[model samples]
Target: MRSLITHLAALTPEQLSDLIAARPEALLPPEPATMAELAERLNAAPLIDVALLGLSRPELQIAEALAALGDGCDRAELAAALGVASDDADLDAALVRLGEVAVAWPDGDRLRTVPLGHVWPCPLGLGAPLSALLTEQRADDLRRIARRLGVPAGTQKAVTVRNLSAWLADGANVRKVSTTAPADTQELLHQLAWEGPYLDEPTYRYGRRTGPAQWAVEHGLIHVAAHWGAPLQMPCEVALALRGPDYRLPFDPAPPSAPTRPVDGESVERESASAAATALAGMVNLLEECGRTPVAPLKTGGVGVRELRRLAKTIGDSADHIRLWLELAMATGLLAPTEAGLLPTEEYDTWCDQQPAEQLTELLAGWLSSEGAPLHQPAGTGQPVPALVHTADGAAMPLLRAAVLRVTAGLPPGAAAADAQAVTTLARWRNPMLLDHLDDANGLVEGVWREAQLVGAVAHGAVTDLGRALATDQPEQLATVLDRLLPPAEETVLLQADLTAVVVGTPSRTLTVLLDAAADRETRGGASTWRFTPSSIRRALDAGSSETELLTALRDRAAGARVPQPLEYLISDTARRHGAILVRPVACCLRSDDPVLLKEILHARSLSTLGLALLAPTVVASTAPIAETLTALRNAGYAPVGEHPDGTVAVERPTRQRAVPLPRASDVVTAPLPLPGPYDPGALDELLAELFEDADESHPLSGYLIPTQPGPLATSEPADLARRLLRAAARRTSRR
Candidate 1:
């Protein structure tokens, strides 16, 4: 961080101005204005939280592991404990995540979780205490030993014991662990490790009944620790010696990569986007139908088997295609779920109104704005791979998608490759295992077409105008490239003698409502066909359209083609029967023009509840009124007036209301995986200091840990030191 600050400080003012002006997100609070400001932000807790939430699960797990240990641990030991080979992708990924977040860093080939409790407040597991791993017995024995040595209690006692332990630890082996040795020896090591690395006694047995305590004392392997609240001490150097020569516990090698896939063009021609286009077209048509006659939602909130098959037949598509498109519509905000059923949301209408290019952008962008591919699954898999459901393969898909786009962007003009090539290329770069499951090969390939080629992001397997725009992150370029695919909105249709009208393409909202009102859509596609009928005409009148108004709208929208005679006749005929009788709601009134009918009604027992009143010989009225009165009168075997004011019977139409679409979700981008950068000397020094202090406080017995001592462990004569050096030189010259 300091080095970064220094580098930024040295940059020219003009360069800094350009940087701040170009990227607004960089200037946010905790934003660095200079090297000093950057350093301050690096230390801020809020910034750390921001980094933490972005971590992958393994990275977070590894971090918490370090937090629990509260110190540096060897790489090999971690690999052994995790049961992951050293070169395993997961371990690599975890290490990468830790480095990116700056939560852990390398210390002499070991990893040290830095800033301790601040970095991970809730650690995965707490490390065992030091005394449990070292001591053989209780503190009472250490007190007796102190008395025998005339070590008085207090600061003086602490110093005297510290000196003794330091002397005794000088040339001892503290971490000598043997797993394949005798059962008793292994048992002894297990007992000590399970107990935590601590010592509270002076005397000990090296094993269950070895009785090597005093012998070990004479050999300088164990001594009293008057400081650090423990009774025994094992020096740092000896602990390192106890670990195998290389120190780290080792891991097995990673499995070899599978043989390269053959470049078979057999599936090449099958990659045309007709299926995708049909799927999209069907998606729109199905949503519109669902809005018209919604089916019951499944108990699990998905389309039930009955509804699925019904929808599939309605759109003339397979069940899988229908399901895929239905889900895609919902995911892309083009449709939403309502109590009635799945329906085209308000966003659908707005989306329809958009130019084709813009709509394609929304479609493709929506494709990118998710975590998992619901439609992309391996063969024989029952569970759907929806967003937020993390799996090894599913998790890597986003990065894979991003990487391929980048690869395409880097390609030269007019240079292109098929899905097979792209998939093969990406697999080699990240994790080849991703392509091992062959269940979703078609889906994997289709994505390239529907998500990329169709959006103008890639053309002929090469990144083109819009692709360049997205790759370069230029909004205006994207718009410019997509303009070619956007369909212009129209408000007219062509009428035929068979009472059918064809809208060549999508029409404006007003025309769509009119068509929906007065005609039944027979076929939907690039060009949709609608048929006019008497019932459909009545539907128009029910939606507040008068007979005359309906005729005018039809003629105006008919592309100047005369309204079909059948359509006109159908409209007039429906209008003629539109209204014929009138009934006004009233509390109570009665008059009769026919004395016989009046007498019949007056003699009826059912009329007793109404308390029927007679105001004239020609009319009769009752307290029960309007709709309810009509039903009661009919049930009583009497016919009554319940027509509109125009003396015409009313035809009912379903009140269609568009549901509010869910808020437009932000487009998701797989943020680039962060790589470890060069660490500044100042930060390294601070971290090292903390690690050393932790080691000094407790003699770490972990095979993974290396403890620290403050001063020289022991003193020796010059002649002795010379002789030790000569023997070491002799050992070095000999064969292992």
Candidate 2:
């Protein structure tokens, strides 16, 4: 790059003109590009020529894929890999883009990338390595598909046609699961635009069953239900998130792992992965609790203090542990507030059902993409930390998180740079004139690192596989890299004599949730322990589980352990005691045709002790009250009668509920949240174009004499005129 400019600087006027004629694009960059300034982007993907930026993301991918396949690779191969029709005009257009200025060229019947393809290990600012993207398995698949498609030998587009035919015919068989916000969810999000910065639970009414708020809750579109009876309205903050400019649900791309580390790398890598798995497993366990019994939100909004404490006790961890894990779940849109209590959203449930590795990847992405600093505040600080939005200083946390990730993304794999140095270097590169509210770079980086670790994006002082994908903001590739490292999920558990069930690897969310309901987690790791307690078994029975469901869940998750007798006894006993207490509210009570039933109710445990002074063999006068006695009667299994003053049997019914009418269209606000400005490439593009345009298109300047502007006595000297016109023409020739 230095020499290209220096050589131009030294070229005599004659030589300059002649050199420009021989290789015009070299002197004048080909038109329409953003890549010249791509170096400034945080990811710093492999550098490419300015011209290459002219293509869209898809076009760039096509161009680069062709380059990877070598000169022998043809349009058929590229089109197949890219999943585009070989003869499609769009494909032709992309090919033409590569050919401009010899970045690629038509070689006989096949098209090949030239300087652009040859410039880097891969081209067009693609961070993916060729080895990863075009694996032997993939190439072999292409070949096999070609044979299946009956492509003729030596066919010009043989490889591509085969790949394309195969992908077209069988690709649908490959199921894809990704987080999505459906129409119902989107409508609920739309309501948040004008309704508020936050919905007031006590006063605000649910608009409709179909509205965004309800849909968001049902779908986990907003992690917390904010439900004031349950599933709270979408928060102003979550609404803002849903309104991101790029409306597609955020996803990390298929991963492309970085270069392997040298020395102690194997041990360090495993340790890092282990740490990530551990952290993620903790959050998942907490999430399992929410699924079991969602906690109600405080009247003020957010999880209540008492409820948080209860969760801590139940999880068998300290309150601090509860707060950290709970907030992290909320921050990641996996937990939300509800009238019933803070619980996992529908989105969380759907996500939880995915494979273990995918579950971790999704959480890591949410952790990185979150705009708030749930973990940034000092412990015991009076100020309540924002769940997942702007930081303490009001600067967008997403931007700060991105900055830190960028620094790590640029480091060599396994290299551990000082956090302060990374912060300082980032600050120097930051655009101070535009953004505001971020002054504590060191603090921001440190806090972000801590949160990153807890969310499993980083481990052992380095970015994990998921972290690198997240740091690069290439969510589409997370699966690619992570799949290689993901251990198979544990489908069952080991039951011991002590009623302890152990999981060997990444535990299935389904199994975990079921086990947590029927058992208590005693320890977590490769082989997590969950002891089946009597209370835990009762919890399962109380949750409306049939005995078979409980037995099946236990048997399936128990790997091959013989069902312990005590465990079976606990389940059976809990089932017996499960519905003994059935209470109902009514205006009146205390009569029954059956004398034995009334007597039984009066003597029932705690109930009779409370106040069932019998007035008659078939009737009881309660010093307690009708409602209290009614509850006691049910618990005692008496099913006593409630009678009106007229001696008629009484019945209770609830009022019918209806959806609230939505506000007038004029009243509902719909607006997008502001986002940080992306870097501009227009200026760099113009500079490259201006420096390279030819003085004239035809006739080598070395052979032909220069001509003055037509019909002018002398518009200017030939040399000066040539230079000025060259500059002017470039501005016009360069496409944006």
Candidate 3:
């Protein structure tokens, strides 16, 4: 296929046209149509042909077909013969030929076309030849035409051969030319050229408005018009005229070059000096206005060179004028140079203050009115006071006046004006005189007055005494005066009350006894220890005895008893020390209901170690059961006996008895007790003898005993019964 296309592309335009006209029907080798067998054909102008055919077709085919037909062959004639519209085409071959005709037309300002009369074989079969050729031209031109006709630009550009034939056959002008003038018409047009075959009104305007003449006004175009008119109406025009069409109106030019060298030294110095003097004059004037003094020298009745230089710098003036001003001020006795800076004396200050306000205004007005004066008010406004003034000699008038005031005012008390002037003229001032001197002048007398007032000097004046006495009385006045005179220290003192007791001496190690009557026997070592109950002390006193006596008795009672070492020491210490001390109250009483037990406890000289345990039952039984102790004892193989609901107990019994016999010095005895013999007269006699013996011994039970025994033999013969009982008891007791 590529080879076939390449071969076809290599063909002459005529051959290609013939091949296209043939229109092969199959991809394989095919037969060609006979030339005599003509197919229905379409014919039109080249413009319409090209619009329909597109640019990629063979141009020669189009031209050859048109040539084959006789002259004056047009789309209209061809469409008529084919029974279609004048602009329509019957065959694609005819459309391609028309495009070739349009391409051959000449290029010019107007849309060029060949007269249809130039073609052969009228396609419409008309006897007369077609008048003209119709063309669509470029797509853009077609669009413009459509837009002018109010048709939307989106309308397709392709025109049927019939349409072109009809449009051209009407004989209307088929071209457009813009008559608008160029923007630079006033300036010579150096160049000319055709711009477009298709144009719009906005595009024409854009071209005409080029150049600086249309530059925007906001870009710094100055208005030179005196009155608002055309020049003002179009300021941009003026700008453009000055800057030219291509010139950038808004561009700023480069800055002016500076001088290569400064002015001659002498001229520069003169200028500087002049400026300095002018500034100094201004300062002097300002000071006077502000009621300040100016500095001056004492020697020459003027400001010294150094002082003048200093003042000039301060007031932005030259040393020369400053010196002159200072000299005049000193001569006039208005300014004085002291240890402080140059200052106006009191007289000068007073004069300055008292000077009429109008005088200042007049001076200011006069200065401002002078020729070439810079201090004048603008035109059309009320006359204003001059901010500065200069004499014919360039001496600042205000400064001279201020300096004179300073010298005069600063004169010492009783000192002549001439003397003050001399002092100021001779003095060299290193500081500003105006403010310093004015302050000093007022401060001198004012300071003294302030001090006087502060010290109550006013109160002590002659009228005060008389007034005070008249207002009140002599006594009141004296008291008031004294109160005022006396210092606060002499008037009052703080009396502080000492409420807390503070011990100042070291404490002694004195023994103190704590008679805890609530302490039970378990807590006490033994009765031998001086363990007194709360009731014991009360009982002692109740029995007509003092605490000291009771304590002594206890001490003596425990003196020889065996007890714990700590317990003995505690008892002795408490008895010796606590007895004499004044205790608020001491009482003792039994906390149990067992009076018998209490009596038994009292009768004993000292309790045994196990005696406390035995007493526990009675104590518990008499009071409460002591549940905690009972539970503990029961768990330890001891049973509670006679326990009551109120936690009281009569006794506690060991749960089990020991199987072993008690140890004795003589022999080992393991046998249990034999049953007692039948009751008899001898048994009673024997028990009585044994009881008597046991009672006579110093033992635990010796104090409590009864001398009685049970027996029936007493009713029989007393001699026989006694004899029998004695024998029987002897026999029973002797058994081993």
Question: Worst lDDT window (10 residues) for model 2?
Answer: 37-46
TM accuracy, model 1: 0.49
Model 2 scores a C-alpha lDDT of: 0.48
Error of 1 at 168 (Å): 31
lDDT tens per residue, model 3, 26-115: 001111121111111111232122122222222323333333232334544333323445443333444544333232221221112233
Q: Judged by lDDT against the true structure, how good is candidate 3?
A: 0.28
Residues 1-736 of candidate 2 have per-residue lDDT tens digits of 2222222334345543443222222222222122221112111111134344333334455555655444445667556655556787866765654443234556656764433434444332222222222232234434543454343323334455444433322322111100245565455455553343233333245633444454343322232232323334332223323344333211111223333333244654576567566666767767767767766665555555677677778776655455556655665567765555666666676676787677767566455434455555544566644232344543345445655555555557656545544543543233221122356555556777776666555555556666677665464666765665567677878877777888877777777777777787888866788888766665566455756778877876665646777778777866765544332223333555566755776676767455655566655566655666655554654334344566553443212221222221112211111112122121112122221233344533211122222111112222332354345445544753
Worst 10 residues of 3 by lDDT: 503-512
Poorly placed runs, candidate 1 (over 4 Å) = 12-28, 37-280, 294-297, 304-306, 318-324, 331-334, 337-349, 352-355, 382-400, 408-416, 427-468, 542-544, 564-570, 573-651, 658-736
lDDT of 1 by residue, 557-624 (tens): 88884787877887888777543223345554444356677667767897677766665665566777
Looking at candidate 3, what is the lDDT of residue 494?
13
Best by TM-score: 1
* Candidates' C-alpha lDDT: 0.50, 0.48, 0.28
TM-score to true structure, per model: 0.49, 0.46, 0.13
Model 1 residue 575 lDDT? Answer: 76
The alpha-carbon lDDT assigned to residue 709 of candidate 2 equals 20
